[model samples]
Target chain A: MTGRTIRIGAGAGYSGDRIEPAVELAEQGKLDYLVFECLAERTIALAQARRRADPEQGFDLLLDERMRAVLPACRANGVRIVTNMGAANPASAARAIVRIARELGMAGLKVAAVIGDDVLDQIREQPRSLSEHDGTTADLGDSVVSANAYLGMAPIVEALAGGADVVVTGRVGDPALFLGPLAYEFGWSADDWDILGRGTVIGHLLECAGQLTGGYFADPGVKDVPDLARLGFPLAEVSPDGSALLTKVPGSGGRLSVACCKEQLLYEILDPGAYLQADVVADFRTVRFEMAGPDRVRVTGGSGRARPDMLKVSIGYQDGFIGEGQISYAGLGAVARGRLALDIVRDRLAITGIDAEDLQYELIGLDAVDRTGRTGIEPREVRARAVGRSRSAYAAGRIGAEVEALYTNGPSGGGGAVASVRQVLAVTSVLLPRDRVAPAVLYEVA
Target chain B: MLLRDLAHVRTGDKGDISQISVILYDIENYALLADRLSVEVIRRHLCALPIFSGERYELPELGALNFVLRGALSGGVTRSLALDAHGKTLGAQLLDIEIISIS
Candidate 1:
């Protein structure tokens, strides 16, 4: 409430797919803040693989080369950016961003790396218990592929408050990046739950970048939405009374209408009455949307309740190890032949004295009938996969090694040869309440 | 459907869908828009496609019409056509309606 109205923009395009276009918009000098969301569950494994290949590599390496073109203009224009492109390696991503800043001759720009979310090490040290929503306890003895804490806006607010112009973070609550700017600019305290909830709603609205800017409007007749190939992301100009205006860079692709803004507002919310996030539960029912202009929408009438005492936690663990091999079959009964091959493999594993609990099998291309009527289809070809799990990683690895012996010893009446078995880690998930896990035990690595 | 008669249409978000609330000039005109336009009339004629999924609704208070769509997020499945990511685009497409206001 003490600061001037600050406008912040966020977009959902990836650097590999839409980097150049985003850079062009940055050169236009239209935004006060920009946030880029580039991380997903699968992206975490990819980052881990890269770090394993070369420990010196960082998370931003996954962004591809196209983003390099835009760093200079972004720095020159003073449009501070917050990106989760750091993935699991925030220090590496921060170092890369700083290197880019230096190469562009932009000096004295403070870049803050918001770390401590990657909790794999901490989970191992303490080995806490987690229960599911159904009240079942998750088994931690299984192998866990990856685990990271979903950080909230407080760390981000701390980064910005430290006078860092560009903030880079790992897996954080997607909406928190946008809300962090609000908290920093307005001096909103952590205990201001109502305003924090309202800010989170605004962040969710603009989180997808182009959705609020008319990229997905249902209206049939709003014409000429600018350069769609270079669509600009959206910014929310918020007032202390909890009203906001959604707009994008001028001359960018896409249009902004009440319809488009409302569409983004409802995405992924489980309950309209209580739209929950890591920080708060935003009430979408109390919100209102109005058409302010050709490419602008005014969002008002948003009200917030209180926040939950416990923070929702995401816990991941090793489920098992899996090995998959594929072969093509032609002509009649292709699916039948594939099923036969699977039975032979299972028989072979049993013959080797592998316990039933230690093994699992799946056929990707088979048809099965159920109450729903024809649950799956028989494709032209099928990829059969087998998985194994045990208390030890070596036992799982041995199961993967056994799959390759089938290529020469069993099945194979016709068709192509079975590929060599590839060992893969298995992962599972559970959720725990705030009290069971302590955040103080996890320390940020500089 | 007559473009001028679209004045009674209203749009909003309900959960994961972008709902368009439309009321025809009268009960008889309801069939006219339904028969003439089809759902594509609104979708194809609209600028931001793929990112939005649509369904029609009826409101008796003002004789209104509504269409709710599934995906409206830019990076969501509506833009990429991926089944897993389309839910984010639902509400963004709800804000794109335009009517001539013929009352």
Candidate 2:
């Protein structure tokens, strides 16, 4: 029997977000669905590298851990699972889940995977300039790693309609993950733009999970949120009309208030009158929220225009590798020592011909984050950091090695020197003709 | 008085654009905030920043002002060398803007 009101919990916001809160929400929130919006901009590039190494892999790093933690509670509570944890590979992720269900001895757990977001090969054939930039995918050329289009809600709802217990996907729009359950439960029409717009609003609210529940919203004493240590994940009590009461589980740590909601409502948003997503162009300009009670706020007044004709594709490429090293200098003449360390690294890079595409020599305690070059007093200690993004890992490794050599090379009290290098995968967006992208869904039961 | 005394702030970024929302606690303060937080004023206030341009959008119903700062994050979180690459700290940077009461 379908419940009149569907409550879906936002299990995880980013890929590495806490798993314990998801367990708490699934076991106690009485949710019909738990959605995990895990993929971030550069994460897919890393996933692509995984797929290159092993075809059986290419899902979120925390997928197995998160699924293991949440599956028992969800299955026992009759809650369904939905996530974009599939990363670069939905099929493998689905098979993994099916296998996991068998291992857990929960037979007949239906799992569905939505595919076709990866369009790198197709994009390569027809290279075009990115959104606002002059460069095409061709310019990125052979360095191109992975290409994925942000999909909408239709495929997810299709999977849910087929009686799947869990839905795993790759590169669906963040809001589309949450909107799927609402459309599935409320039986909302696919073309119901206003309802979709309202659903989009809730999806945006719950997309980041803890953010709406005061995770990033807290300011101690000034704008206080209680019990933030054990902050609760968000669950929307969504109704048929595409409106919902935004709240969290009782006794949860974080505060759910209009102040918090307002911030998240506009978070990462540009042109509030027209928030273009895969499904609809949601308008939150007229959005209003009122507290129904403590931690209970009713959100309403969102409308929609037509969806965009093109879908945004996140194109990840091997931008090169970043090498970084840091060394600390303390006591008198620390500022001078830090300056000397930076100068040495600079000179070393110049002498070594490590012509990095981008290089930074920062006196960390002074001008690292703030570019103002303001040091109130010559800090008692300052850390000199040298970083460079270069074409090769070998070149990237040298920037730090050059900095570490400063210890024996002598700049006075150069201690705690460390160096490391890692491949850098950069991301940029390009619009693809939506019709050219064919998203498909398949279901399997273990 | 500090902008924080009158309003709460949130910051978001897209590519190089830093989107900031200044939401007032009281609906009445919208007028004062609207009058005070102008494009020129904000541009000048944040002139010390590495950003290139600023544009503002007002939502009076929600008692909020949305400011989109272009070239703010250098190249954004993925590639920017800034520690706060996403420009998440821009809100606190913005809250530092003082709004003297006309009264």
Candidate 3:
């Protein structure tokens, strides 16, 4: 083990669900590095829509206020912070961080913004005749909500190497935050795939903070832990040989257990034998986890192969319009009545010559078996629902109007009440190979 | 069927679905329980009526027996509702399973 150990502190709880307790742990631990990850598909769409409405409102700026409250305590204890909370806009996020650092009177603080993962503009720049691989002509009929490329750790590593205390990035791989620190500390090159892969795994393990440290463990009985409202997040003390010990802040709530570690290990990964990321392919099966102490699980004996040549690109497009409405049914045969009401509405729409592209109907609260041919007695009440798509919003609205009419015309209409309809923006996604989205296409906006 | 019998149960809709996670301790024990009770036993004892039209089976990856039910509500009365079949079953089915576990 090297004396200059590479310690990694993972920041979690950004779903606004568990962030407060997670943040408290970071402040109390006096950690070397703090990382917060806050990105999801739907979140990207929402952020993009906000950016379109106002360029400055893209990223999750709410974190700024939260971070501001903690920055003083973190600075006082000399802890550095890194986060992907930048979301769609990194420079803007960095600017906010800079202001906070200055306000805190932290001298010699360097804030770096890692950008260039968004490729929405590039996708548009291509000739209008370009196809989407399946021979379907590319069409931007509706507004483009979001377009972000998933980048690796190079930019973040560069930011850290340039002496930046806080690194803010947009749409970076979750593991990149953890990998960036290792690369900067060990002087690992971009192509040094082996160590980079190990570092990526370390990042993946620690990304969710308390997750590996026992936040969602089935065993070790986490429910019995005291003060879960103030649970501490996990941090890894990684060695040069790619070995790591997982532990949380002292005096924290959760306990580190083998079951919790395994649960997190199995979360999003599709294949344990081939865990693919932009940097490396880590083999989780070869990796071993041992409970070292009270809140410490030692991670070791992991191996890696090579990375896939093509990077997985997430492309979103406009599919069509969708709308939905719900109605409630009560009393005898409630489940059957709900289903009958749905059929009545569909039959009414068909008779009215409504040409919806597709239609779906469901009866909730019905004592109905699943696709496996299981059945049960009808419930006392059931919620009937339907969904469909059309070429225009007007066509979609027609479906909603018809559903409302059913309250008076359908069998269950005597008692059933129709809820207001909701219209959804249509979105679809496709994957393009790495070669299609070349690095030259990416650029930083001043 | 006991909660432990549902070591792996996948519940989702046509294309997109959210995870309704249930962790079980033993796979073999759960499989044996599933074989004895099947979906019929679950519905009779648990009061969870199957909603979808197609045949549902167990998916090992989800670590739970999965049933892909169709025509379930998308939280609305129109076919354009965002609620999928699997999501509609969550409330009644999960409660039924919980009752079975306690019993």
For A411-445, candidate 1 gives per-residue lDDT tens digits of 56434444332233322234435444332211121
Error of 3 at B55 (Å): 19
The 10-residue segment with the lowest total lDDT in model 1 chain A: A366-375
Give the TM-score, chain B only, in order for the candidates. 0.52, 0.91, 0.44
* TM-scores of all candidate predictions against the true structure: 0.63, 0.96, 0.75
lDDT of 2 by residue, A1-446 (tens): 22588898899999999888999999999999999999998888889999999999999988889989999999999999999999999989999999889999899999999999999988899996887457898998898999999999999999999898999999999999999988888888878889899999999999999999998887887898888889999999988888789889899889899989999999989889999999999999888999999999999889998899999999888777888999999999998999988998898889988868679888877877663333487788889998878878898899989989998995988999999987767788899999989999877788
Writing each residue's lDDT as its tens digit, candidate 3 over A79-135 gives 667787777777777777777777778756777777777777655665233222333
Residue pairs clashing in model 2 are none
Q: What is the Å distance of residue A142 in model 1 from its true position?
A: 5.1
DockQ of each: 0.05, 0.62, 0.12
The DockQ-derived docking category for candidate 3 is incorrect
TM-score of 3: 0.75
All candidates: TM-score of chain A: 0.71, 0.96, 0.83
Worst 10 residues of 2 chain A by lDDT: A366-375
Q: What DockQ does candidate 2 have relative to the true complex?
A: 0.62
Worst 10 residues of 2 chain B by lDDT: B42-51
Better of 1 and 3 by TM-score: 3
Q: What is the alpha-carbon lDDT for the whole of candidate 3?
A: 0.60
On lDDT, the candidate that comes out on top is: 2
In the range B24-67, model 1's lDDT, one tens digit per residue, is 43445545455444356566544434425555443332233445
